[model samples]
Structure formats: structure tokens, C-alpha cells
Target: MTELSRRELVTFLASLGIALPLGRAAFAQGTGGGGDPAPGAVAADAAAGTLIRFKEPVPYSFERLVEETREAAAKPYDPVDVRFADTLERIDFDQHNRIKYRADETLDLNDGKAPIRFFYLGRYFKLPVGINVVDGDTSRQLIFDPKLFQIPADSPATELPDDIGFAGFRILEPNSERDWIAFLGAAYFRTSGELDQFGLSARALAIDVAMPTPEEFPRFTDFYVGPSAVGGRVKIACRMDSPRIAGVLEMDVKKDGPIVMEIRSRYFAREAIGRVGIAPLTSMFWYSETDRGRRVDWRPEVHDSDGLAVVTETGERLWRPLNNPANVMTSTFGTGSPRGFGLLQRDRNFSNYEDDGVFYEKRASVWIEPKGGWPKGSVQLVEIPTDDEIHDNIVCYFLSEKPVAKGDAIAYDYRLTWAKDQPDRGRVGEVVATRIGRGGIPGQPRPPGVVKFAVDFDGGMVASLPRDAEGVEAVASASRGELGKVDAYSVKVDTAWRVTFDLKATGPEPVELRLYLKRGDETLTETWSYQFLPLAQTG
Candidate 1:
């Protein structure tokens, strides 16, 4: 997605009722009072402390949270009250940006090793969510106080009441000005990753995304945060509620090189859902090298991720390049308890992007590694039409084979890795780049209704093959077109191999194309799967 304007961002946040607070301040020397005070200590400070306040202690645990969620699903959905809606509406983008969370009031965790801060409610984020600090078996709800934020004198936020709730919270990089992980707006949360650049975002669950009906965004109404049992990790238990579903998510988040999150979620459906997307990843894909014809910027390429990479349960690897379709398109790949899948930014060269301001090349590639045994499902990819990068038009998620029904209780466990690369790509030739153009040989009259595809593969056994490798061939197939002029050879400068083929479309419908390099009967590279839009292909 391209960079969103402040106004556009506000609108987007307003639609999702989620907003990522802006601004960062230098880390203060002292703790946000004191590190995780003993059980009732924080509650005791409710009457004494002015900067931070907490409600009476309450017994809490992940299991209790799940049970509470199940109970919530059995009842009618209750929406969070928007306190001082008029005042919040007055706090526009400019005024909201001026309102900053007080760094001195940060809640210290792990002896101040990880500083936690709360987000202020604004125009886009009028609804408040419960923020609690967990201490052992007890938790205290953080009381909202106007003093927690440094608001401009002229800001409408000044009109908000002292009991007004928070929009979200973020975990700062220990003693650093920047934050590593942030949870805001619905069930959306993301990390800066190892490169310190935030790109794609992952949602706890997605209902009816890209479906005929409007999508349902489950909001994390409350969060219980504390130190994790695992060393150097923070545990966050969230209570998510929606009109159709109620759920609990327990995340063990740790930042070791690549930010890793062990996520366990349980959902109770209040009503039947047309589609349920688990561990859904949302990103932007406007234009890339392969689809340069749709470029609207001066940069060579613009996208958060380049392709959707999936490893099937049977060990088949597939790479599908992202697209900016003319219309909303959904692709489904039957992946029965797939090993892993993710939207990756494989092209890390800065030269390819030429975008220093946002550093598109440094965007993190988020991967979902399923834990335990997932039921038979398909990895669904939804590509919506987007002219600019500001819009996140790409969504990838796991869709269970069975349809979700009312009273259906489901659970999913997965590990999320936000890093520069996927966790396990396996020992195989991977697709480095995919380019398309007019079909046929250079300097010759190109065939009508035909498109040329050039796929480059690097590493794996393909790298070791000779330039004139005997028996090496490009295996190609198309769903609704004829494939010809297939060729495969090693590049002169490097061990990278290149596969070229031409596809003649017989109809206007999109064609599913697949290609891979093979030496005799042995597969030499990961399968390159693509949706060839005949009508959208530019000559």
C-alpha cells in the first residue's frame, strides 16, 4: 500500500474504529511509577497516584478470559460507549496528532526493561477499550485519566472526561524512544520487525472478508498485559467481541532479532459466518516490477510485499506474485494444514524501490507458522483494486474447509514471525522475480492475446546446474490458455536460473498459470503460480 495521507488515515481508522497513536518521546530515567507492583500495590495507588490510577484488583487468568468470552458470545453484543462523542469528533487529525501520551507515565514491565504506554482516544478512535495490568493471579484495570496525555491547550481532547477510556496501547523498545509492538483498532496489531519498519498488519480474526456481505471486524475490548512465563517475553490476553463472534487471544510476544509471537486464540460464534479467516494478514500491493504497467509513482516499485509464499502439508512450495487487479479477486489454494504461509517482501534491494523516505525495501515479511494440527483448509488470497499505495488492498488468511455455524467453538494456534524473511523456505530454488510482457521473441511481431512470462529462480539445486544443463526443462501449465516457447537456462553472471514461456489466452477470463524448473523427474524449484488476467495485461 502507498503512504496514506493524514486525512485518509483518519478515515480508514474511523471505519475500523482503530487508530495507531502517533509521536514518540525520549525515555525518561525513572519508571512509570514502579515496575509491576506486587498484586494489590497498584490498586492501592489508585487514591494516591495522580499520573496513573487503577481499579480494585480482580482475579484473572487466560482460562477465565476464554470462559468469559464464551459467555459473551451467548448474549447479545454490547458496543462500547463513545464518551464525549462531540468532543472526540472535534479532535481532528491535526489536533489528535498534537495529543501525545506522557512518557513519564509509562507502565514499566520486567523492571522497566519493557515500557508500556497507552493511546489517547481521538476523533477516529472514540470508542474506549479496557487496559489492565496483570500481576500474578490478579489484574487491575487502568483507570483513564486526562493527565496521562499531554494535550494542547486548544485541543478538544481537553473536553474529555477523566473516566474516558483509552484507544489502545503499545510496548516500547526497552529504554528506547521507538516502540516495537503496538495493539490498536479492532483486533489489529503489528510489530516494527528487525528492520524497524512496519508494513503489513495481522488481525486476530477476519469474518466475511472480501465476501458479498460487509466484513466484520472483531474488536479487542479489553487487554490484560503482564510479564510472560517465558523469559524476555510479554504475555497479553485479549478479550475480543463482535456482533457475530466473541473470542480470547493469548499472545506471548518476544523481540529477539525477529519479533516472534506465539498466538493462541479461541472463538465462539454467536451467529453463523460466511467465511472465517484465521491469522489473517493485511497489506498493500499497488504495483511491483512484474506489474510495472500500473505504476503511478516515480519510484521503480511500490508495495509492502511482493508475493504470497505457501508451503503445503505435502511439502510443495508455491509462490504467487501479488497483483493490483482491475476488480476484487480471490484465489484459493487447498492447503491441508499447511506447513506455513506468508506475504513476503523478497526483493530487499533498495535500488528496486528507490524510496528512501518510507524504506519500502526494509518492510518486514510476516509469516504464519501453524502450531499443532490445523483442520483441512485453504490459504485464501484477496486482491482488491487499488490505484495508490495508501490503501491496503491485499489480504491473506487461512480458511477452514468446514463452514462456521452458530455456537461453533473453534481454536487455532500459530506462531507469527515478523522479520526480513520467512522462517523455513526449505532447500529449494526460490522465485526471486517475475516479469511479464508482450509474448513472442524479441524484434519479432508479438502474438495477439498472448503474454510472455519471465521467472527468475535463485539458490537450491537450480544454482548448481550447468548453463547448458541437459534434461533440464521448464514445466508449464495454464488453466485456460496454451503455453509454448518454454525455455530454461542458467544466467551468465550468477548461478540463478531463468524460465521463460508464452501463454496464449483463448478467452477474457483470468488464467491460472503454473511453472517450475525440473531436471528429469526431480523438481528443481518451487512452483510459480500466477493469475494471468488477459484483459488487464498491458502490451
Candidate 2:
């Protein structure tokens, strides 16, 4: 089998309505070109078999699943064998859409709070997953039934057998008109966020992503859904396997205002996996205001997430503005059991995006909160280049300090909140905006290769301070460049403070810049860090 790059996997998943999380540059090697199989007409298989049945109410528990997955990981990986995969692989987007799950067949789980609908096997989603329902202490596997799908007569999906199973499934809203959460395409899953628009995605695991070695994509082969003992909560269990690791995941999901999920993951490595990423988030940042000249898109801004926010263990908050760099870039922040981190869509106004169709402004911001004392690790942010919004170019996750050897076991407990904003500790001010332009005097022959940046900070104690407050200073530094013409002042509009500066390039490499507002001995805002790619975007 030819190893697939992360971009190729994303391209295939995006075709199936599951946008791949993360981005890649325009000039960089991409897998989004043509040659995907076209949609074909219905070709029913005469030898279709009946749906397979497992004993109902079989004894089951979260612990049992973890144990079983551990034993499975000790053995060699076994890839799925899809029957009539060639025909299924031809189910294009339109054809896949036509093969919808009938409303009458929606599973009535959890006292009918949300109906469960199965996704059909298609070209991009060829792996069939086993699904089950749990009641009390027992669980029963759900059999695949072609009759559950209303396939168009012209679609080739009818050719698949009744026992071919499902690609993944979704949880329909109370009205049954739309789905709020979906798990499809490998280990990828996402919620509609607090705004009910699906933009980015969160994965179960990430292995060696953007590394020299080809990335490993683990898949959830089975799912068990049940009513949680906790009030108004649902329990979901997953059995995931891959060439590198086998694991079990359990989530106590609640459709609160923020769609909170308490996730517990157990992993047993099948091999000596390097660089395991936990609680991975994937998003897209095409051309925002900071790099307006990068793309010719009509929108003023285009991005699902604009920055990666982190709260260190010592109560210090840091904000790193995301970018669509010319080349792939990875930033790691070493921390000892950090409070939390997330990729956030802080700009909430529709005017910022001017995209009414997709409503990018309403995209949700996801945050991860560790349940206990997390081991020493680093919050890693990987930014890839992309010319279009269709490609997800930003990925943020936690990398463990310790390496995992073959047969080693790892466990994590965390909470995922899909909210409009991250939890505000109200410790200091926040960066509201970041803008860049040609660095030079207004009309004095725009200097070559100089970039100007303006960062806006608002809220917290600084906004409440009098405009004439003295001793307010902008402390800034660059890792590999010369900082010039630095100025900081309080802007009357919105009672925000703005810092303007010019960066004189010292080399061709990208520069890491950090700045924070302070008044005498007291810091007034969280550190604002940005990656300045001199050669990537220019006025």
C-alpha cells in the first residue's frame, strides 16, 4: 500500500463533507488535485447478505473495552477488508448525499433526546465501523441495514451489501433536521460548536504529524453509545486501532451551552511511536487581516481560528497569533502541567468576515482542560500554508515529554469545551487584533523588506485605566530580527491599547516576536507572540 500524506488524507475527507483539519501552502506539495473517482449509477449486488447479528444485551463496560483493546494492540494490526470496495469508492459527494438515512430508521436512544443516524460508505469514507447501543450494563451491536438508507436509483451505493456496515455516524438534533456532532473519516470528529456551525475538528490522536516520517492515522473501528448515569449527559465509547497504537476512548457528552465533553483515553502502543499528540485540534487560517495580500479572495478575512491561546501553570496567559506561513512551521511551548490551551476564533463580529453564507464569524472555539496534574509536556502548534479556505492549515496539540515504547500504556483525562469563547480568568488584557503592513514612513519611498505590525489589546484592568495613566510601556523582543520604531499608546476607540512597531529583517528565516504591555512593575496584558515570515507575505 502506498503511504498517504496528511494532505491527501485531508483532501479525501474534505470531499465527504468532513473537512480535514490543518493547512498547507500553495507552492508546497499538495494532494488536492484531480483524479478522484466519479459518481456512478446504482449497481445492486445480487449476492447481498443479511445484516449480521451479535447477542443482545451482552455484558459490557468501559474497563472491559480498554482491556480488550490493550490485548489487540499487543498483536499485529489488521486492516479492514471492505467487500465491493471498488464500487463503494465510486460514491462521489452527490451520490453519497443521495444515499441518506431515512428518518424512520433513526435510532431512538437516551429517551429519544437525539436520534442516531449512520453515514454511508463512500469513496473517501470506505472504512466500515461497528456500532452498538448500550443499556444498563449490557450492549448490543447494531447490524447494517441497506433498507435504512434511501439511495437514489442512479447511485451505485445500492450495490453494497447489507453487512458492509457504516462509515461513521451522527447525532441528530432534537428536531431531527440536522446533526450537531459527527464522527467520520478515520479518527476525525467534530461538534457544531456553540454557534451550531462546524468549522474545525478534534481528533482522538495524532502520531508523527508534520514530521519527517509519514503520519499515522488511527481509526475508530467501533462505537458504543449509551445513556450516562449523570443527568442530561450521554456516554460514548470508542475502540480505536492503527498500525501504531490501539486504544479505547470514553466520553461523557452534554449538549450544554458550550457542548462539554469529558473525555478519557487509554492507549496501548503497538510500536515505538514517536511524538504522540493528545487532544489534537485542527483548523483553517487562510488569509486574515494580518496577511491580507496573501490571497485574492473576496472576503475581508477567512479563517476558522486566528490564534492559539494558552494559560500556563503559573497563571500567565499567552496568545500566539496563527499564520499561513509560506512553509510549514511548528512552535512548541514547554510547560509543566499547564492550565489549558485552545485554538480560538476571538473575532465574533460578522463584519470581520463578511461571509454570510458560511458564517465564519460564528465558528466555535474549542478548549482543552486537563482533569488532573498533567505530566510535563509542550503545547505544540503546527501551521501550514494554504491559498484556499477549504484546506485546514492549523493544528494544535499536547506532546508528552516522555516517549512511548512498544507495549507501553498511556492514559489521559480531559474536558473539551466547544464554546464561543474560552474561559476567561480575567487576569489581564487580551489581544483583540493583529495587523501588518509595509514598514516605512507614510509616503517616503516604502522601504524594501520591512514589515510593520500593529497589535491591539483590550479588556481587563488596562481598559479601565485612565487614558493618561503614566509609565505604560510596550516591552517587545524578536528572536532573530531588529525591532524598530516601537510605540505604544491607548486608543480612544473601544478603550483599547495599540502597539505599533517595525521589524527590520536580519535574515531570510522567519522571526519569532513577543510583546506585552506593562505599567511600571505590573504587567497589563498577556504576552502577544507572533511568527513573522519575512518572505511569506509582503505588501
Candidate achieving the largest TM-score: 1
The candidate maximizing lDDT is: 1
Q: What are the Cα lDDT values of the candidates? A: 0.81, 0.80
TM-scores for all candidates: the values are 0.92, 0.90
Which regions of candidate 1 are displaced past 4 Å?
1-50
Give the range of the ten consecutive residues with the poorest summed lDDT in model 1: 25-34
Summed over model 1, clashes come to 5
What is the Cα root-mean-square deviation between model 1 and the actual structure? 5.4
Local error of candidate 2 at residue 171 (angstroms): 0.9
Instruction: Please write out the lDDT profile of model 2 over residues 1-539, one tens digit for every residue.
Output: 11223443454365334654453322101111112223442333435543234556788999999999988988998887777878986786545645656554567778888677777887777888989999888999887777656566677876777677788888877654567788877788888878887778898998898899977888899999988999768899999999989999899999978899999999999889888999999898887778877768878898889899998878788999898888899999876787899999999989888976667898889999988778988899998878776677788999888998998999999999999989664668899999999897896998777889999999897788788888899999999768889999989787899999998885668888999999988999999988888777652
